[model samples]
Target: MADLVYYVAVTLDGYIADSDHKLDWLMAFPLGDDATPYDDFYRTVGAVIMGAETYSWILENSPEAWPYANVPAFIVTHRSLSIPEGKNITLVQGAASMVAAQARMAAKGKDVWLVGGGKTAALFAEADELQRLFITQIPVVIGAGIPLLPVSKVLNLKPVTQKVLKSGAVELVCDVVVG
Candidate 1:
């Protein structure tokens, strides 16, 4: 089975994006030497699952083409959205378990990248569908913004690994404890 990994870059205060739902703060930082972390991770992803807002952000920001064109992408959204032509993207609405099952099948033994927007990741985490979390902690603190996981209940995580990047960013990997 493929592991559902919520691999994302977060602020020091645990925000994925600012209040405006923009990544301007994150984009300001330069990718220091050995910036291949994302490329390395991307090589292992076979499928992707993201929320509607995340999808919309990508569409608006990356107008030229879809970033994850090679992988099967699933967008969890209640609102209607259009998929770019020739892209392997699916718009779905349902329980996280159901959506995760589809993503897992599409993953074909590779990992499922949970391209998140907090709410969506929370759904998977709340449903116990998320397996791992890879958080790249950016140095800045956004004060207030979208949380890393906005679940009402507590979700335990076991640390797997930690690394400090050349850019003073920290990368922490953890396994979502299933109880």
Candidate 2:
């Protein structure tokens, strides 16, 4: 079975994005490595899941034409969203477990990327479906913003890998000890 990995960038204070849901703060960081961590991770991911807002944000902001053309993407949303032509992106609304199951099926033994804002990621974590978490800790502190993991409950994670990226970002890869 493929592990569900929560790959996300966060501020030092543990914020994923600003209140406006902007990742501009993360984009400005200097990536010193020639190889991108995302590219390597993307190869292992067959499916991606995110919240409605995160989906819309990527649609509006991503410079690429189709970032996940080959990967299946599931967006949890109540509101209708515009579909990008020739992309395998689906809008869904349901219990987190349902979404996780669908994503796992789509993954076909590959990994699932639980990508999103705090609340959406929290949903998977709460369901105990998210097995791994890769946190790119950028050296910044956003006083007020969307938290990295916003859950009423706590999930314990044990570090499997930790390294300082060429971009000066601290990457902490952890196995979900108890989700």
Candidate 3:
């Protein structure tokens, strides 16, 4: 079975994006190298699960070619959104448990990446499908924006790994201790 990993770049104030659903602040931070420190961890990802808002945001912000071309990507959306031709994107509407099951199949024994939208990740967390959280915390505090996890849930995480980047960001990998 593939594990669901909610990997995100968050602000010190626990935000993934701004109020207007922009990541410009997060993107402005220097990454320093050609490849991020998370590259090794990302290499194991086989599929991606994201929310409708995240999907729409990516469509608006991403390059001409979809970034997750090879990776099987599933978008959780109740709205009737159109997927561009030649893109391998699947829109699903259902409970998180059902989506997680489908995501496992799509993952093909590799890890399933919980791509974006904190609310969507919260659904997975509530379903007990989220196994880990790899959060990269930037030094700056934006004060207000889209939260890290909109849905409230107590998570007892056991630290598995940690890394501090040259850009003054700290990345922490932890196993969610599901109780």
TM-score, prediction 3: 0.94
Worst ten-residue run, lDDT, model 1? 30-39
lDDT winner between candidates 1 and 3: 1
Model 2 accuracy (lDDT, Cα): 0.86
lDDT of 1 at 128: 97
Candidate number with greatest lDDT: 1
133-154 in candidate 1: lDDT tens per residue? 9998899998999999999789
User: How much is the lDDT of residue 26 in candidate 3?
Assistant: 79
Give each model's clash number: 0, 0, 0
- Across residues 19-121, which tens digit of lDDT does each residue of candidate 3 receive? 9998888789985673255668778998999999999898888758787898889999999998988877899989999999998898889999999799999
What lDDT does each candidate get? 0.92, 0.86, 0.88
Query: Model 2, 39-129: lDDT tens per residue?
Result: 8989999899999888878878884776788989999999988897888998988888899999999999999998887899988889888
Q: Could you tell me which residue pairs clash in candidate 3?
A: none
